[model samples]
Target: MKKLLISLTAAGILAGCSASDSGNGQEGPPETEVKTEEDPVTTDYLQERFYEGMDYDAYAVEIQTWVDKGQASISDTVKIEGQEDVSADIIQVADGFLAVANDSKEITFIKPFASPEDAKEYLKKNL
Candidate 1:
């Protein structure tokens, strides 16, 4: 009868609107976009007391000048007495060497002696 036909039509409509039928005709759940972030660069001072409040960029340029002038050479690492071996760029000055951290660009240690023998003597007396 008319009621039976209407019931069938309604059932057909309900079936069409079921959750399984995505309007886009795709199967399963929709994919979401994922975003990733990078780690931030950090700068720190190892010996803050020796920091003369100079601009880091200027200081770097000055260090580069020393390298250019053959007054200093960059080394991969420096070993400090009574301290852990540090990964740094060693700068040789007239008096001693300056241990600069590679990542932080901070002066980690300042030795006011020209040679290893002088450094040993100084460390023996001081520490």
Candidate 2:
């Protein structure tokens, strides 16, 4: 009789401990983190289009003008290859903008002499 009682008590303790160890007493599958991979072509396009050197203020004004005209829109973030995702002031012209102004707020415009169609082709290939 004593052994039966002791076994029952041990089982109860084990059950309680196991339940507490599991999260919040909630019965459901464990939570998982979802990671989305950035497209390499898009990353390359952003890096190639917007770089360290270029006229930011001029581009900003031009882009803002386009935005006012409803020809463009300013967006929030872009994922660049070889760099962490950055919050940038992105001007979308036509299919996409030729530059971006990053966190430093310095905008980098399109490669000096590249045509808009060239930029568009570069982005359109894998997009």
Native-to-model Cα distance after best TM-score fit, residue 58 in candidate 1, in Å: 2.2
RMSD in order of candidates: 19.6, 17.2
5-71: candidate 1 lDDT, tens digit per residue? 9999999899888845766575432222121223211112213223433334445665565456555
Score every model by TM-score.
0.33, 0.31
The regions of model 1 sitting more than 4 angstroms off are 1-53, 78-87, 102-109, 113-127
lDDT tens string, model 2, 1-127? 9999999999999998988889575543222222123322233444443456444554455445545655556543344444453324544444344435343345533331134454434433422
Model 1: clashing residue pairs?
none
In model 1, the worst 10-residue window by lDDT is 39-48
What value of lDDT does candidate 1 attain over all alpha carbons? 0.45
